[model samples]
Target chain A: MTDPKTQTGSRQDEFEFFEESNALWWITLAPTTWAVHFVLAYGGTAVWCAKFGETQGVTVARLSIAGLTVLALGFIGWLGWRSVRRWKPRQNDMEDLSHPEGRHEFLGHAAFLLCIISAIGVVYVAMPALFITTCR
Target chain B: MIRSLAGSGRRLVAMALMMALAGCAGRQSALSPAGEDASWLHDLWIVMLVGAVILWTALNGLFFFVTRVRPNDWPERHANRLIIGGGVIFPTVLVGTLLAYGLSMMPHMRADGDGLVVKVRAEEWWWRVEYWPAGATAPIVTANEIRLPTGQRTELLLDANKYIHSFWVPALGGKMDMFPGRETRMTLRPETPGVYRGQCAEFCGPSHALMAFEAVILTPGDFAAWLEAEAAPAAPPATPEAQRGQTLFRDEGCGACHAVRGTEFDGLVGPDLTHLASRQSLGAGIMEVTREDLTDWIAHTRDIKPEVAMPAYDWLEAAELADLAAYLEGLK
Candidate 1:
C-alpha cells in the first residue's frame, strides 16, 4: 500500500499543477473582454454603414478589425471556460479528506478559486467603460 | 457597562464622521442657477423613484414574513409566482413610463417663443456671444462672459465652429450640444442676481478641461449702461505711454488676430478688445486681467496655453510691454 504521506504529497503536486494552469488560462481571458468592447463599439457602426452601401474605405477597415477582434475574444473565452469546467470537479474531490499533504493542496485550490473570483469582478467593473460609444 | 458605553460612543463618532464626509462633497453643485423647462418628463422621474421604493419595501416585507412563517428545513417552497409577477410588471411600468414622458417633453422644449434672442458661437476655447436683442444694431459681439438682465426670457442660438461641444450651466438648464453646421436653441432665465460659472462639458481638445466662462446676471440699469458702453467705439488712451503702446499694438501683429473698434485693427479671429479694460478677467476666464498678467499674456501666449493658435510676441522690449499693458487698461 502506498504510504499516506506519499499519497498526500502526490495530491499536493496535482493541486499545484491545477492552480498554475488555472491562472494561466484566466490571464488569457482579459484580452478577450477588451476585444469584445472594441467590437461592440466600432464594429456595430461599421456594419451599419456597410449595409447602407456607403463605400468609405476607412470605415470598412475599422469594421473588419472590430469583427476579427470579437471573433478572437469569443474563442479565448470558450477555451478558458472549458478548462475551468473540466478541472473544478477534480479539485473538489481532492478536498474530501485531509491528509499530511492535504493542507498545501487545499491552499493551492483556494488561491486558484480566489483568482477566478477577482477576474470576474474586474470584468464587471470594466464592462461599462469598454462599451461606451464616444463618436457618431 | 463601561466597555459597552465606550463601544456605543465610538460607533456614534464613526456615523457622524461619515455624515460630515458626505456633506463636504458637492457643496459647489448648489451654486448653479436653475433648470429652464418643467415638464411631465421630470414628473415621470419622481413617479419611477416612488414606485421603486414602494416595490422594494413590499417585496422585502413579504420575504421577511414568508421566511419567518416557514423554516428553510421544511419542504422546499417555490417563489416562481413572485419572481414572474415582478419581472413583467416592474420593468414594463418603469421603462414604458419613462419613454412616454420623454417623448411628450421633447416637443415642448423645441417650441420657440417671443423672447430676446442671443446668438452664441462656440470656437476652439472661448464663447462669442452676439446680442441680437429686439431692435439692436448688428449684434454686439463679446467673448467668454455673458451679461443678461434678471427676469427676462432669453433664447440662446448656439453654433459650434469645428468639433462637437456642449453648453451646460447646471443651475439654469440641461446641457445642449453645439454640433457643427447645426443650430441648437436653449432657453434660460435667471431668477436672482448672481454670478454663475460654467465650462465646456464635452471633451474637445487639450485645453477643453480648462475652458470656462461666467454668466453675469445684472439689473436692467446696469445692463443698459453696459450695452451703451459696448455700442460705442473704444475711447483713445490719454497718457503718452498708452498712446505709444497703441501705436505699438498697430505695428505689432496683435491687430492681425484681435479687433479694436475705431482703429485699423479689424481682425475678428480673436476676442474683441474694444472694451478690454471693462472686463473682470482675461485669458478666457483663466486669469485676472492685472497689468502684470496682461503683459505676460501678450508676451507669451504659448506659455499660458500650450499649442495655442495665437503666436507669441518675442520682439517686444520691456518698455513696449509696459506701454501695451497701460494702453489695454485704458480701453474702457
Candidate 2:
C-alpha cells in the first residue's frame, strides 16, 4: 500500500527544504548573520577611518553601521518569524512526535531564539560608531 | 623536615601576597589612578569584573537549582523561557550596556588639550621629550624624563625615530602608540603631584624593558621655575676635577653624538646632557644619578642597559672617569 502522506499530497512536501528530517543546519543560520555583520562593521570602520580620518570618517562609519544594523535585523526578524511559526507557540501542540512539523519543531525553536540573540549581537557590533570618531 | 617544609610554604604564600599588594600601589600601576582617564579605565575594569562574577554565579546557580533541586525535565514553556531569558536576553542586555558604557568614555578620555604641548619622540631605547610653554617660540628640549604641570590638561604629541613604540604612564593616563613619521596625540591632566614612572609599552629592541622614564608632576609655579632653569646654558665647572673632566669630555669626541648647551659639544644623535644631573635617573630611569652609578654606567654601558647607543668608556683611567662624573654632576 502507498504511504498516506504521498497519497494525500499534502502542501508540506512542496515546501520541504531538505530531503530528510534533519533541520540542524538551520541553527547556524542566525549566528552566521551576526558574524557577517561583525566583519562588515570592523572592516568598513577601518577603511573609512583610514580614508577620511577623524572629520568625515565618523559620520560615514556611523551611517554605514546604522544601515548594516537595520538590514541585518530585518533579515533575522524575517527568519525568526518563519521559524517561530513552525516551532508552534502552544505548549500542547509541542508533543506530536509522529508529525513531521513537531519532529523538527525543537530545532526551529532554537533557531528562532538564536535569531533574537544575533540581532542583539549586530547592535553590539554597531555600538562603537556611536561615540568613536578619532583614528588616534 | 615536615615543619621546615610548612614554614617554607607559608613564607612563599606571604611573599606572593606581598607582591600582589605591591603591584596594586606603584608609580606605574593602572590601579593607582592619578588622572581622569586612568580612573575611568580602572572603574570600567572593576565593574566588568563584578558583572562577570554576578553572571557566573547566577548561571551556575540556575544549573544547580535545575539539576539538584528539580531533577525532573522542565515543562516546555518554562524550559524555553529559561534558555531565552538567561542565555540570550540577559547576557545581551548586560554585555551591551557595558560595551556602550566603555565606548562612551573614549571621547572624554581623549579630550582636547588646554594649550600646553609636549612632544615626545621615542628612539630605540630612550625618550626625547620637549616642553613647549605657552606663547614660547621654541621648545625646551630634554630627554628620558617628562615633567608636567599638575591640574591642567597637557597635549602630548608622540612619534618614533626608528620603529613603533608605545608611551604609557599608567598612573597618569592611558597608553598611545608612537609611529615613525606619524604623530599621535594624547592628553593627560595630572591630578596628583608626585614622581611617577613611565615605560615603553611596545617591544622595539633589546633594551625595551630598560626603556623607561620618570613622569614628574609638579605645581604650575614650580614647573615654570624648573622650565626657566632648564632653558639656560650649562654652568661653568666649579671644581678643578670637573674642569679637567670637561676638557676630557671635549677632547675625547664625546661631543660628536651628545649635545651640551654653552659648549662646543653639539651633536645630534644621542640624548641632550645639558642638564643631566637634574634628571631623576640615569640610562633612561635605570639607575640612580649618582657619581658612583654614573662611573659604573660609563664603564659598563652595554652591561648595565644592553644595546644602549652609548659606547663604553672603559679606556679612561679611574681618575679621569671620576673627573668626568664630577663635571656631569655639576650640571645642576
- Interface Cα RMSD for candidate 2? 1.1
Residue pairs with backbone atoms closer than 3 Å in model 2 (clashes): none
Q: What share of the true interface contacts does each candidate keep?
A: 0.00, 0.78
Q: How many angstroms is residue B263 displaced in model 1 relative to the true structure, after the best TM-score fit?
A: 1.8
Best by lDDT: 2
Q: Which ten residues in a row have the lowest lDDT in candidate 1 chain A?
A: A127-136
lDDT for predicted candidate 2 compared with the true structure? 0.87
Query: What lDDT tens digits, residue by residue, belong to model 1 across residues B156-225?
Result: 8898988788886654556688988998887765555666666788998877866677767677778878
Supply the DockQ value of model 1.
0.02
TM-score of candidate 2 relative to the true fold: 0.87
User: What is the DockQ score, from 0 to 1, of model 2?
Assistant: 0.66
Badly placed stretches (over 4 Å) of model 2 are A1-29, A54-57, A89-107, A133-136, B1-19
Q: After superposition, how far is residue A124 of candidate 2 from its true place, in Å?
A: 0.7
- RMSD (Å) per prediction: 11.7, 4.1
**Against the hidden reference, what TM-scores do the models get?**
0.60, 0.87
Using DockQ as the measure, which candidate wins? 2
